[model samples]
Target: MGANFNLKTLTVALAALSAASIASAAGLDRSGQDITAFLQDGVYAEAVYTYLDADVSGYDNAYVGADKNAYQQGNKIDDIAESYDFFRYGVKADINDTFSVGVLYDEPFGAAADYSGDNNFVAQGDRDATINAISGGEVKDFASAANIVGKIQDKVENGGTLTAIEQAQLKKLGPAVAVAQADYNMEGEGTNVEVRTENITAILGAKFGENKEFQVYGGPVAQRVQADVKLRGTAYQAANGYTMNINAGQDYGWLAGIAYSKPEIALKAALTYRSEIDHNLNVSEIFPALAGAIPAAATGMNGEIDITTPKSVNFDFQTGINPTMLATAKVRWVPWSDFEIVPPLYNTGSKADPTNGPDGLSLVSYDKDQWLVELGLAKRLTPALAVTGNIGWDSGAGNPVTSLGPIEGYYSAGLGAKYNLTENWAISAGGKYLWFGDAKGQIPNKFAVSNFEDNDGFALGVKLSYQAKQNFN
Candidate 1:
């Protein structure tokens, strides 16, 4: 096969070419659930690093009162820019021609958001509607009374007589002015959440046939989750300073998949399914005003909440256009509607919150499933260099997504490169630009918004691999 048969180059070309993507897809999913590592042909091990940055903007908060329209005008909220870093490691070995085993480690689901920006979304304040309106009204009446008093005083000094009504209005000026000078805004706090997940997969599989081979694999997956949510901001000012901390919980799930390949033409197709993991998380909550209050904390408010991460399926295919060129395609589906983040303590409503949420008291959730697709091509420009490019589309899970995790859909493109430093070592790098589809910024109690459209994201990644020994047989 000459130099045309370098397996190291295949790893580099497919480093960023999984067609399974990361970031801006759906429901805290970053790693696209790729299990292709188990399908590698020989003894292989690699470490990968990825950095993602997302810039989200165009936010609007609905204010409901006589003062609603004026307060939120020009409501271009914070540009939610966040940077995330991730690393993954994997090792696969073929004990013999028809049997293989491997282990993979990665951060499968996560989210980090800091609403601190030019917007008041995270501002520390409690500008109550009732208080602001009452005080503002006082100021309006005070100005009228003061103006009349000033005119009467000037007339009397200039030797002009004043009416009885004018004298009465003058008497009200002092107290009215005091009421007008009162303060309103309290402070902005809360309105944020953080999530993280880790996965470890152990696999065993067998291959059959000599020409177009067939293989099947299955494994147990262990997953862990953690979260911290601060309930403050526009709609949540009612719970303004409340916070919830979900202790990390680890559990087990499973996965199964099958693959077929024609190594000579570099063609392979595979399908995989990942099962859902359920967590009954131990949680602690803090609410400043509710401390030691009647019928609040003494009732086990800091106990547990049930959370379920959704299941998903993946299909991946790749073929060699020629000995030096490759093409690939992939599709994925996730049932995000079944995913939820509900705090049990918050589920019981108070007079402060009459609505328990029509969809349920969710700190994070979606109303629909997610669909994603990707296509790509790779070419070896020389024996030591290879380049690849791909395009992708994601059908968002919901049109009006929650403010906690807001995005509808996205279209993306990426470029990747690999350099073979030696027969045993290789380096790979890639970057992708994602155009977020327009979204109707939604808040529970179902606030409809035409905001959060045309936002964008960027992802960059690199990988290093080592091949200890080769099949020189």
Candidate 2:
């Protein structure tokens, strides 16, 4: 029965922590490439449920938030992010002595945030849900405005020659200054953004030749993606009432890998490569200001961004330390630089043409690829109990992170345990903690931000597994 289970507690611990604790790997990465699917034996299935109670403090609207007099020194955005729950299930079967097949259902990538509470981002007194409507055919015009009211204030106070009529305007300068200040602080309450992706993978594997020391596996992966972006606060004043909802879309990719194992001492090593998938997502882009002024198609003009999820490489190894102990390690790399999501027409016609993206500026872009490593130890304490612990590190996707996610890297540690309820059934629990690397989020063409640097996260999970008739001998 023990041999039939073949479950690795370390993998579950890593997955729970990766999904819940690692803020740097938060967006689009829920699983840490755990090989639990392949670890299952004949007619075996397991279900895992995870909950992440994560939040960040000290996040501030990037626009006029820094001006102490306007927003205050301790102007912070708290709990902008709420807790989340995730689940995954999989089954594996042994077809014959040398062949096996498996299937998995999992949420691979997702992101969420809520800023509906009271905050400093909203235009102090102009707390309207929708302000400064930007309609279709005027998207570029609106994006190019670049704080026109503030510019006007500058001219009114610093430059320009005016007559008595203009001099009269000077008397009402207080109101004009207030309006300009409100525009500069557009990042408002109710600003929220969410993205989700799920995957289904079918796998085939075989072990043959020389006492079945070598194993090979490959699979086809299908994924679905959906997202919604809302611009609210004072920092986003120019884009007030702007909402983008991307329709759910499905895409396909492939995975292949090989492994070499020596069961005598429980030594195993494997390497897997996954292909990138392209998605031509259909979306509805709305500019509240131009709701009826422009045709629907013109506002929805966006088939250009073929959202391509990045490819990745995973290598894992484990060796028995003693009759009841094992040492394990893994290395994973993702080319995040090749992945970017920039809504077409959002910032079209760049004032200063960018070298990478022709779409003016990207909604999100990674400056560097990601590299992650893990080291762990697993021990079987008794016939019914087993424990696993691990520590991990991840080189985040970028250095100067974007305001969207301000993590540059992370360090993590986790622990897990499993107890056999019966010979064929087991219950498990795991938890992880992550220390996020400090980062200075920057707004293109604007000043740098430093509020999300000292953030952290935590994750916990539970799982249940069952296996058909098993053979321990």
Candidate 3:
């Protein structure tokens, strides 16, 4: 191979192979936080959009019988995974041959899951099935208690007075009556959770080598996060009516990286590190079912919840396999095990129990860090057209994951194509299919509540990009 090879033309063909990507993985990671746009030869800009849809269903855990002595599998849970989408934009320019600056915007982290159907994950008017499953059939007849309470209410509302005997009965059955009424009031409700986050990063880089083959870059990143959660159904027991609203919060972080390139071989490599961003969000929580035990939970409390998105490292590399073919690889690591979300009031109430002590439970936490690897190949079929294919694997955050997002990890395959409308403009499209790993769903305190298996999903993306060529010599 000669250094005289048309590197600029090759760059255009290979760039599309990396254009429209879907890196849907564990621990709320989306978009893959790609920064390749900054590495292009000259002035480059791109806009990308990605959409993901998943089908996640499972079986709820239940008591073996009225005795509730052992756990058993219960009703079929409906699909909880919701379709999600996000956008990304990046632009970079050489401020001369030695200095370069760029900015990237993306939605980097998020989750969405909603549950419904006749499973324990939903609340119904009768609630008899829910109670039986949750209580091991011991509290057999909720209808009888409901009837007695209803009669007392009817008499009082009709301008009648309660007899002494009736009053005594009311006192004895008051707690049970309250629970039934609460369940009734929440008829047809289901558990749901949604979280969203965004990031904007700015970078300044300097090329140093005699041939300008080496570069170092560093910059600041700003991020915003928000979330909403609702827990319903007997599946949650005392926490059944729990709800949390976290207002949007913005914070800053840093990014640094080093890169190397060889225009002769059309080769490039980069190692990037992103610092964790912390957001102190205003949070409001209501735990209706825990009202009596935790008065603050029932009345709702407002406080601050500190959430730090995990730090990560990414290695991206690509090289020409031949004149018309390019090989690419990506490896990413995220310390998901160190990430957790804990609500102040919830933690305090949990610690009120001697067994829980000071290290109370978190609303969400992962058991392990995540590792993801992807490999791909792209071929320029024509001067204006190129196609690419890739395979990937993700080591999930861990098994027995949060019931809110129960997936372990995924294996995926994808295909993409790019078409150049002109020498400086291109459009790309890609699609990926993911096979999700089976996992047990868990709640706070490491309690397993459901089993999900054989779930799958797909992602689609499109990108429009522009680039102006430059000589690497």
Rank candidates by lDDT, best first: 3, 1, 2
How many pairs in model 2 have backbone atoms within 3 A of each other, for residues 3 or more apart or on separate chains, i.e. clashes?
A: 18
Which ten contiguous residues of candidate 1 have the minimum total lDDT?
Answer: 177-186
lDDT per residue for candidate 2 within 360-473, as digits (tens), equals 666667778888887887778776777788788888877566555667767888887777788677777878887877665544323343356577787787878776644433
**Where in model 2 is the C-alpha error above 4 Å?**
1-27, 59-74, 116-188, 288-304, 349-358, 444-447, 468-473
TM-score for candidate 3? 0.88
lDDT of each: 0.68, 0.62, 0.81
User: What's the CA error at residue 110 for candidate 1, in Å?
Assistant: 1.2
Candidate 1, position 228, lDDT: 86
Candidate 1 C-alpha lDDT tens digits along 133-214:
2233333343454466578778878998668766554443422322222211224442576888999999888887764299
Each candidate: RMSD to true structure?
Answer: 10.3, 7.8, 5.2
Candidate 2 positional error at 151, Å: 16
Global local distance difference test of model 1: 0.68
Report the number of the highest-TM-score candidate.
3
Model 3, 3-97: lDDT tens per residue? 44456656656666555466556988887899999988789999998888899998988653423223478889988999988999999999888
